[model samples]
Structures are given as structure tokens and as C-alpha cells.
Target: MLGLRPPPTAAAEYTLGSPRHPDVRVRVHWPTAQRPTPAETGGLPVLIYFYGGAWTLAGIDWLGWDRLFRERAVDAGVIVIAVDYSHAPEVQFPAQPEQGWTVLEWAHGAARELGGDLDRLAIGGASSGGNLAAAVALMNRDRHQRPIRLQLLEAPALDLTLGHVDAGGVNKAIPDVILRQMAARLVTQYLGTGRGLRRHPYASPMLARSHAGLPPAVVWTAELDPLRGDGEAYVTTLTRAGVPAVGVRMIGQTHTSGGLRSVVPAAEHLHRDVVSTCVPSTHRRWTIRIRCAPRTTGYEPA
Candidate 1:
């Protein structure tokens, strides 16, 4: 057990098991309501989030993510659970997805105890975390474990095979070659001795046998991002498979733009869109979708 820890106003570091069941750690952010609880929900809608870092602890020591999470919880009036999952290389591919699935299962079973509605569960993540979220959705779909409401994938690293990063365009952010190299090294480390696992659905959801029956997806991609093509393609696949999916490509932004909300307008808009998309509508159903033409093949403009 950890002795000294941060305060729990925005997020409380919660443990799933105390040397009983397999131990799992997470940071859960509970919302603030006017009354004792919201009317529509006897409990709060839970948004399980995974931070971006190629499955690594990127900013665990930093306070930025915690602040944004807290603000989003208050604004959206939902329980925000940010997972501090183990990193790759050390733990490898299957372990990452396996632990994520474990967290989702634990959250669903413990939702009521934590004052979160089991029926209103949503999952979201950024970058590599986004990839894991997508994998979890697909896992749930195949296993029929739980019904997920929405999947918010922000600049997800979907195609782990490494060739998809070379979009053959210049936008002034990280170059295609560097991005490709990074992906190659990361994939090598993640797969370790199991190189063929790259094509596995849990490792790369974009390479899934079918995109049918998965949860509705809200895909956020950056125009300059290397993974933009894969992210948008996943949206197209979902749409064609009859799932109501929307892909938003933020112009003049990079892969990690979702984390720069305070400085960039596009980033801030993405942040607001996430909060609004997860939160209940005051008037009618709220969504970030726009009417796309029949032949449109790319992302919807943001």
C-alpha cells in the first residue's frame, strides 16, 4: 500500500484489490452535483480514461492531466476514471490489453459501489491509450462482457504495423520518417518475441476481421498527425459497418494536440467536444457530428 499520496478532490487513487483479487490501480474522479445526486441517474455516468504515452506513464508526476480531468468531471457531471496502466516493453503487448480489459470489468462490477451508473459507461483515451481503448471496445464486443455506450479515440495509434504512419505529406510537425521510426521501435518493443501479435485485433483494432457490432465511436485525429490516416480509416470502417461513427480532423494540430487545450483553439474545442459528447444534453441529444456527403472518404472537418 502507498503511504503518502496526492489529495482526492479531483481524483482519488483507488485500488481494485487489496491483496485479495489481483491488484489493479487507478485514479478515479467523482463529479460534483447540485443535490446529493443527479435526477436522471441515481449514480453518475462513468468515463473511463487512459492517458497518452504509448502505454507508458507519460505525465504521472505532472499536475496538468489531473487538473484537466477534474475540470472535465465538474463540467460534464460524470465520474472520470483515469487509468495508470503499466507500460510496454517491460510488460509487452497482450499484457497491456489484458490489464485494460481487467480495469473495464472491475469498473463495471464496482460502478454502483463508487456511485457511477453501470448502464452509462463510456471509454476514452489519447494516442496509445486511444489504441488500448479501441482494443477494449472490441474485446467487450467479442466477449459480450458489457455494453459500452461510446468510444472516444483521440489520435489513436491504431495500426501498429508501422507502414501506415508514412502519409506522404508535409505539415511542419514531426516528420513522417521520425514518426515511422518511433512506431517501428515501439512496436518491436511492445511485441518483443511475439512479433506476429501486431496483427491481433486487440493489438491493432484497425486490423480487426470486422468492425461490426462495436460501440459507436467518436474519433479525433489531427491533420498533421502520422496516425491520422489510420484513425480516419477506422471511422470509415465503422460507418460502413453500420455503426454511427464520426471522425473529426483538427487542422494545424499534431498527434498530441488533444493535450494542448489551454494554448490551442482547436485543442480547446476538442476538449469541449469531449466533455459535451460525454455529458447529458440540456435540450436534446448532444453530438459533435456533421452531415457528410455520400462519397466523402476522409475525416469530417472540425
Candidate 2:
């Protein structure tokens, strides 16, 4: 349902792997400061990102990722590499995770080529893309790949089984039953016959047997989203496992609403804060101390 649009801003495109089960196409976004070479400032920080589409739709043109590409690069002075993983109905579950893994592995090993510092690599995404980001971190930890310094999950669908949803907190526009039905379709399309079979932790990360050793993360959730339960639950799991994890429940909003900066003030806060947290301030290139300045408890704006 998304149209093919050339990146509306300046970015370098590259093809990674093949077009089969796990091949991917990626774009590397750079801050427009000095146009420094790949290893600027002894290598700039890298943000490995995935776009949200419920493992079925969306690409770089999605409002969230596209906006980040157009505005954040210059302000943040960081490099963002977005992965275009193959969607479902044509591919399947493991394919998406495998593609995510391939991109992570390459990013971890080839940071210098992208004008990035391996030491500051972070991963993030919106919606299903958020799920994939968490899965990639899990895979990285399991595979002993370079540690992911931070993870940013926005309205992530962390649990595919989704038994934790109460639907009491969701918005009227997105009813609980309808959301559940959509989730069922997503899982069915991605897992196929595997629904009756085994559900891998990598596929449904919250279902993972453990959450220890995962990187610190900022889990952003919309108050009215069914996946809010999943993101909140994941934060608890990670925190209990000794990972420094924080959860932000965006009140009076639904899933992916934080990306709508033009309409919502809180959404702008979320979008800007996310981009800021992803990159180091020009003054402090090697140090990062992020503290949440939440507005208020309930729906009060910041």
C-alpha cells in the first residue's frame, strides 16, 4: 500500500546481500555538517534502523523514517542506515529475522565503511520494525556480536502470541478486537503453519526464555495501543534481567502516533527526543547520559 518514492533528501543507497529469502537494500543517511568522510571524528555514531509495517508493508517512505532522514541527519550529526527487509505473504518469519541479523552483522563489522563508530552503534524501529530491532539485539547477544549500546523501540509488537492484551486501555478509533484480528493476520502471514508449531523467541521476543544481557533501551508506547502491554512487559523483563530499560507510555495516543509531529505536540517531543538520544551532542562526542523528563503521570503534556 506504500508508493515507491526516491528519498526526498540526500542519502547514499547501497545493496546488501541478495534478493532471495534474506537479501536487503539499505540507505545510509549522514548529517550535513562538514560532509566528513566515513571515519569523521574518528568515526561518527551509527544508528541501524528498521521501518514498521507489521512485517508486511512500508519502506523508507514511511512518514516516521522518512522524516528522520530529512531532518535528523543534520541536527544529530549521526549516520542512520535503514534496512529494507523482505515482507511476508511472499517470504516468512525466519526470513525477516535472518534479514535483520544479516544487516546487524554487517553493520557491526562494517561500521567504518559507513563513516560510523562501532562503539556507539544503536538500533531502533517503529511498530513491527521495533520488534525486529529487539530481535536483532537478542540475536546479537546470542551470537556474541558487538554489543548494541542502545535500542529504541516505538510502539513495538514485542509479543506475537499477544495474550497480555486487556484492550481496556486502547483508543476508540482502534478497537481491541479489530487490533487483535490484525495481529492474527500478521502472525498468520508471517508464521504460516508455524503458528501450530513452535514459536521461536526471535520471532516473538517477549516470549523469549530470558532477557538478560540485553542492551539498555527506551521503550516508547502509545497508551491506547494494544502493543503497549507488550512494550511495558518487555521493559519489565529487561529491567528484571539487570538491563537498564525505560518505558514511555504516550498518553492519549494510539500506536505510531508519536511520529505525527505536525499534529501532536507530544509526538514532536517523542520524535525529537528519539533523534537526540540517538546521536551524541557535538560537545560530548563520547559520553552519553540520558534521563527521562516525563511531563506528568497521565495524559498531561510535557
Candidate 3:
């Protein structure tokens, strides 16, 4: 047992599990209303968000992600289905991605029961979570053709090979070489001994031969993050493939800055951007006027 205190509580939640994927646990967080129902709002959109932990650590119970998911459910007026997929090493490549696919399928199938709109279903993640989200979007396209309305990637580690990373950042306390080494180690841990798997498209979405047909994407990156290159390149490739994609960089912020929404003002923009972006573009619902902050690289859909 983890002799630790339980994490913060959400407004409402329920569990989803399957015998095939016993290790994975899916949690659906509801908005904080006394009697929340879809009748008033027509139906809420759904965001199946995956949290980041380099693909090897952390869970939905992580205080930062727990808080963020709760806020997103209320502000964005969408149901947040936070996935707790199994980590790497203990499991391996394909395992995590497959679990992600399963969760997406489940969410799509249960949308009506969850009081969610099928038209505005989206997949999102941060760092490693971003990688999984991208992979699942690809799977949804290739297999079932699920209507994934949007793909929100924040500081996503798209290229697990670490080829498209920026070595320099605002914080230089750790030398570039050490940072690279640490990142390399994390990649190794996720892939185990199967280093060739790094080149697989699902493992590294940036290396995918084609970025066409994926859902519209809102990619966010921290100016001081090494993963900035991955996020930006993803936007470039997606746009080139005739997909509508937007990339934004948070200036003066590091990789972890996004989790500081409660304390950092700039971080609040992250939440705001997510809330704004989640609004369906082609739907029959309401509209939200988006205004980008000065420090942020503006978000404009192509």
C-alpha cells in the first residue's frame, strides 16, 4: 500500500475497467453542479485527456493533473475522462498505446450515457500523454473512423527518439548534455531493449509517414522546453498535409509551468486556451471568442 494521503476530491467521478486491461483504470470527472444534467446544455462535449509523466510515471491522482482536469470540466463545459494508463518498463510500447485506444473506444461508445455529445469528442494529452493522444488519433482514423473533433497536445513528446528536441532553454542550471542524457535515459526506459521501436509511428507520431486526415489540432509548447521542436514540427507537418492545426509557445515558461495554473498567471492562459480550443468548430452549439495574451504565441486555426 502507498502509505500516503489521498489526493484532492472532484465534483463527481466514476470508474471504468475491463478484464482484458486490468492494469488500466479510467476515471470520468463530472462538473461541480448540484444536479448536473445534459438536458440544460443540450449535451456536454467530452475530452479524453492523458496526463504527462514521460510515459513511465505518474497517474491521474497526481495533484496537478487532478486539479487541472476538474477545472477543465467546469470551465470548458465538457466531460473530462482522465485516463490512467499503465506506465512503461512494467508494461512497454504498444501496451500503453493500446490501452489508450481502448479508452477512446469506450468513451466514444458511452458518450450518450455519460451525457456527452458525440460530435465534439476530443483526445488530448501533455508530454507523453500527447504522444498517446496523437497515436490514438491515428488509430481512430485508420481503424474505426471515430469522430475525434480535436487533438490538444501540450508540450507533447511526439518524437520519442529525441531527435527533434531543442537543447537550449531559459533555465540553464542543468547543462545541455545532462538534459539530453536524462531524456535519452527516459526514452530507453519506455522502449526497454527494443530500441528499433522508437521509429514506429505510434511510438513517435512525428516520424509518421503521413499526418493527413487527423483531427484539427491545438498544439502548445513552452518556449523554455526541449519538446518545443516536436510541438512546432507537428503543426508544420499537419498543416502541410492539409490538416487544420495551430501551435502556440508559452514564452518564459518551462515544461512544468503548465501545471502551475493555480499559482502562475501565465499558466492560467494554458487552461484558458484549452477551454477555448475545446469549443467545437463545426458543431451546433454556442461560441467563444478567443483572445490571445501578449506573452503567448496566438492561437489561430488554419
Candidate 4:
């Protein structure tokens, strides 16, 4: 349970079961709207959501994020499918990535049954989940399979290299040694072999040989996050590959704020921005815009 509390919002009824992959389990969160008849849902898009927890702790029910995600999907007139990829230390290395891809594959066929448009699909996640989202997008591209229309990465940890601190100008409060140790543990566990740190595109999107032909991307970065540099570098890489990308830097926030979207207006706005970016012209063209408040005693932009 991770000692986390349940979301305050009313959750829709759904089911949890093994996906085709015996090792991977999926938790589907249905939208609150009445299920559409087959005739009524000929082309509704779906958003596949991945949750962030440093690729270890946390689950589908942490905070009210899932509820909010479903709400956003309903409001955007899309179906919301959340995947529960196996975590690290037990499942390790490429498991989450593989599980993520597997879930995406399932969503394509499953969306129709759930009354969604498989052709207009999108993927999104936060932090570690964001890392998975980017990786999966690359896999979809490299394999010459599945067309992803959009990608939403919120404060993604795109770089596995140890020297990102100097490049990103991370906050001084995060101890350098501790950061390295955590990264080392993650690499060792996730790859199952230390060789996972070799910077494979499947493991690290930053290492991908090409970002070309990938879908339009919406990347969110926190002004106070240690992973800020990786997100910026990713945006640059995407642009170089000619992929339409938008990067938004949230001021006065940290990586953890994403999980608290229910309580934070800024986080809520960030979620809305991601959904707005994914959906087709339902309204005005959505662009990543930065807003800042005057710095006070303890707040400053990175």
C-alpha cells in the first residue's frame, strides 16, 4: 500500500487482471460517462496513462491522479487506460518498458471494446513513468510499428548518465553522492545487468539514434527538479529530428508536485495542458506557455 491514502474523488468501477503477458498486470480506470454503444464510439481517442514512482514505489491508486486523468479523458471525450507495469527490484530492467509496450498493444484492440478510437491514441507519464513513455514512443518508431499521435512527459528522467547534475544545474540540496547512488541502484535493478547503463534507446530515449517520425510531444519540466536538464536536452533532440515538440517549465515546483495534482492548482493546470495538447482542435490551439510569479524568500528559478 506504500502508506498512501486513497483519492478523495469518486472512482469509477473497473477491473484488474493479467494482460496477455503473464508477468504484467493492468488496472483499467473507466471514464465516468456511460459506456457508448458500438455505433456511438466509432472514433473516440484514448490516452494510455503511466504513473510515476521512481520506477519502484507507488501504484495505480496513489493520490487522486488517476481520477483526475479519467476526468480529463471524459472532458476531452477520450478513453483513459492506466497500466500497472511491474516495478523494479523484483521485476527489474526492461520489464517495465516491455510491460508498457504490451499495454499499448492491448489498448489498440481493447480501446474498441471500451469505445475508443485506436487511431488517435496518445501516451503520457510522470517522472519515471515519463521515462517509460518516451522509451515506448521510441520503440514504436524504431520497430516501424504503431503510430502514436502524441506523447506527454511530465518531468521525465530522460538521462541515465551520471553527469547530468552539472549539465542540468540541479538544486544544491540534493546531495550529489546520494543522487549517484540512487541512479546506480536503478540502473543495476532495471537492467538486471549493469550493462543497462550503456545508453540503449529502449532504456534511455536520450541515447536513441533518432527521434524522427515520433509523434508531437508535450514535455513538462519543473524549475527546481534535478532532471530538468534531461527534459531540455530531449526537447532539443526532438526538434533536431523535426518532431513537433513543446516544453513547459513550471516555476516554484519540484518533481513530486505531479503526484499531488489533486491539491495543487499548478499541477492540475499541468495535467490539463497535457490533455489539451493531445486532443485534436477541440478549441484554440494549445501551446506550452510559461508563467512565473516574482521570487520570494525561498523560491528561485533554475
Q: What would the per-residue lDDT of candidate 3 be over residues 1-302, giving only the tens digit for each residue?
A: 21222223344454555446545677787665543566755667889999999888989888667777877887666788999988877777788888888888888888887778888788999999999999999888889998887889999998988899896765678787787899888888888867798999999998999888999888999998999999999999999999888888999898988877545667878878888877655554423335654543343335
**Residue-level lDDT tens digits of model 4 in 209-255:** 87889888878988878788778778888999999888888887887
Query: In model 1, how many backbone clashes occur?
Result: 0
Question: Where is model 4 more than 4 Å wrong at Cα?
Answer: 1-22, 163-171, 282-302
lDDT of 2 by residue, 1-302 (tens): 22222233447777778435666888777776344666445788788888898888888756656766656566566778888888887988778877888888888887887678888888888888998999999998898767688898988888788776647676567767887897787788887856642247887888888888888899888887778888999889998999888888888888867766556667767865676577675653433344455543244544
Q: What ranking of all candidate models by TM-score puts the best one first?
A: 3, 2, 1, 4
Question: Across residues 1-302, which tens digit of lDDT does each residue of candidate 1 receive?
Answer: 21122234445676664222235578777765322333434777788887788765574434666766676687678887887766766766677677678889888987887778777788888888889999999999888659688898988988888646646444557566776776778888777756688888898898999988888889988887778888888999899999889988888787765666545656657767777688754432333443322322232457
On lDDT, the stronger of 1 and 2 is: 2
Colliding pairs, model 2: 38-115
Which of 3 and 4 is the better model by lDDT? 3
lDDT of 4: 0.69
Query: After superposition, which runs of candidate 2 have C-alpha atoms over 4 Å from their true positions?
Result: 1-9, 18-20, 33-35, 171-175, 196-198, 281-302
| Candidate 4 positional error at 282, Å | 5.6
Two-way lDDT contest, 1 vs 3, winner? 3
Worst 10 residues of 2 by lDDT: 1-10
TM-score, one value per model: 0.83, 0.86, 0.87, 0.81
Error of 2 at 285 (Å): 7.8
**Residue runs of model 3 more than 4 Å from their true location after superposition:** 1-22, 38-41, 170-173, 285-289, 292-302
